[model samples]
Target: MANTPHGGVLKDLHQRDASIQEELKAKAETLPHITLTERQLCDLELILNGAFSPLEGFLGKKDYESVVETLRLADGTLWTIPIYLDVSSQKIAEVGIRPGAQITLRDPRNDQALAILTVSDTYQPDKEREAIKVYGANDKAHPSVSYLWDHTQDFYVGGSVQAVSEPQHYDYVADRRSPAELRAHFKKLNWTRVVAFQTRNPMHRAHRELTVRAARSRHANVLIQPVVGLTKPGDIDHFTRVRVYKAIMPKYPNGMAMLSLLPLAMRMGGPREAVWHAIIRKNFGASHFIVGRDHAGPGKNSQGEDFYGPYEAQDLVLSFTSELDIEVVPFQMLTYLPDTDEYQPVNEVPEGVKTLNISGTELRRRLKTGAPIPEWFSYPEVVRILREANPPRHKQGFTIFLTGLHASGKEAIARALQVSLNQEGGRSVTLLLGETIRHELSSELGFTKRERDINVGRIGFVSGELTRAGGACIAAPIAPYEEARNKAKETISKWGGFYLVHVATSLEQCIKNDRTGVYAKAQAGEIKGFTGIDDVYEEPKNPDLRVDPTQTPISQIVHEIVLLLERDGYIGER
Candidate 1:
């Protein structure tokens, strides 16, 4: 018999002989009852070289030259039972293929028949069925996760998997607050007129311009609501994205624009997504929503086509304006104009402004190559974000996030606490100032609720790790709620050095100081659901230390925190 590339595979298969068949049977029996779309099945067939056909007779043989390499499974070790791509037979007919015909593939070794598979006879309209089918052992077929993972490296600069299916539905992590809860949040504030800004990507000048314009036009309070969920293919994950947001948050019109995560999946259907986005914002209590060109579009399609025309999504939303029960604010694409040295909408930009065509792909190439990302695409804080991302090759650290409102003394208190910890010079203390850690830690997690939880959760985890390693971490964030604080406490306590130091900054002083203009903007009705204005701020019932930003000095606050740590035995050595 002539030798073939799969000769060794066949030999290995034969070696295990009965064991191989038994293993295969077991794997098949335990195989997840997964189904696939017609296209997905076709793709699988292409990948498998037709050994497992969606139509017809079983018993086919094909050489998967690198099956062992692809999966760590050995020959005769019973890899997962052969899975057939599932598609509607009607679709099969539409494609002009004969139904119920057996398909075959050539076996690389001796042209031997080795395996045969079948396809589902019908489509499963049930979503739960689809979810189960998509997640199988050794199957990287979670449609949403797979799609994003497949394309993220191509589109998102320095992209990496940030978070997958995680929960943060309780009040400790997110204050358990909902859109309906906005009414009771800040009893003194008027939320009658609210504008919610929508973003699937991190904010830049262009986003700022659109939000500013929208807020000005509506004469309403702006809520900077960004999604932190599984987005379109190639989009950055939500975990890191939230950190980039937190860094530049001080720039947002404080109190007027509060940031929050939207736990929703992005279909990237362009016009349909825009319509869907509007409906969601409305459900979340937004009176007005922003829809820009190609809103939620998944970029170009096969044949190099833009999924929907620039204005298509906007037009569709406007058509259903009344039905959506929310006002539509259409925005043009924002471009960086060199003349003004800033970003402006395509329509209003001056002719003299030089155009900097910084595509996301180009930016990612730079990041991957260790090149400096132009400031026009993202903020300096975001640059830091791109750097700190650890791609899970090893679990050496955790991400710890400090969250809270503006002028909440989070940064100042964090600094003082860091200085105190630094006094333990021998210990490997790593202080991740929220603003500084955007590049390394926050780049992967996008601006979604799940992402935020992961980001904040990582922060807590890291702090706990450092403390356990005989190091100290002083993370100061306007971690305003109980859920996030609880997560930190839990993570750190597990490591044996847990502390929740609440930097108490009263809403009155935060508004009066007006360093960021956010509070002033909220009062002027330029923004809504401003965390301290329109959104609820749940105070810690009891904290290790409470530093009133209104009256305490930074030094005193830091000292008090250190004392608490020492008293609790979290100081000196691990």
Candidate 2:
């Protein structure tokens, strides 16, 4: 939900409300006057769908006009400030809006629409002023996969228009600036080289020592960039982590470092993530990104050993240096030397300096039980961060992935399996076939590649959800190729007992039994690049159980799968 792309909900709403469509087109026509482009228009439509649909009826009579006026005020700005709304707020007056919408800011004294004000060149001198402008999708979705990180009028929002100083839309900044923008901002301030620290956890002596070392070694400014959105399960929440960052900022070298939020998501990948982090920092304008041990790691696999060692992240960055302009500054694990009353790298400590090594897990445990972290473990400032980032440990579950081709009877097989697994009793079984989830997850303007990735990603989420609930998942998606199937296999296998049941339906038979008429469309070029016809569908070379939908009855297919699970020790014999 944190990384939810805007406009997905608006497109859905526009289908039901003809007025919204008219309003969108009107805004698009007027958006350019306010600096909104064609792309921003599309993005605004999406953001409307994602953010404002549920509140359609709740918006009062005067609110619509306020929205329109807000847009008028935010004219010609490349970056549009989003009109922030609180659906939970009681009064519509308490809510905010941009131009093109019929809403006005609430007046507390009069309990009526605030007097319409002209757009100001400066930030809104009045605290209550709002602005409306269409923000570009690029700004809404920053840190793109490829290059091109510019702080331009690419981002917009739905709200009243006000002066730049006041940020007329929402009262608070929706999010912090992107890394690229931060670098540009600092560069303007005369800071040339920056050392960006990537963190999901709070600062401790080890982290502090490494960061300090990075700054000294690289001769660069330090940027404490912490992820503020959905990290791996059990990680600390954003609010608490921000407080920790605030507390520890004073301890850092003055004028040599600064703190900011990285409005990005984390993928618990170790080596790949290291490369990703480096690239992100490069975009954010960092000259150097600190690659601490096990950087961006998700911990152990099923074997309970580390997925990658600390040096692996460093190695991953070194492996791809020329491409990513950012330098990687790697530092060994830091340990505290009590006798000397200082922190030192594990290798640098003398045999006599009362040395100690305390892990993050141990630190958290002590905190949860209201115990003191050893003085040698972390700085008092750093320990304050640990206190702020203390989150409850959550036990995650496993996911079951099912893949095959369209019309390979994937849905039928998935449904049958779901029923069978449910009948097994005591085990929670949830079936998420491709079609149903796609309808719920996908958008009209969604790109083919993103759609494909998201479709598969949703299946993975479902699998993780089902498995975590201590239940089983039966996901049947037309994976179409060995690569996708293998990815599904690998992702699910991480949870253990990931039975890859390949629904081996012949391509000819699938075309012959086409339920959605996709095959016919593919042949006529009506549907470009359809799988198994114009495109290829690689059959699974090896699957735990291969069922020919043409030959096997649905009942028998389900029984065989259940048998495989039981035989493989995933389920008890029944």
Highest-lDDT candidate: 2
Model 1 lDDT per residue over 513-545, tens place: 667787888778898655677667778887766
**TM-score of every model?**
0.41, 0.42
lDDT of 2 by residue, 285-317 (tens): 678888877777666544566656768778967
Q: Where does model 2 exceed 4 Å of error?
A: 1-175, 350-353, 381-574
The reply for model 1, stretches above 4 Å from the true place, is 1-172, 186-188, 350-352, 390-574
Model 1 / residue 480 / CA error / Å:
55
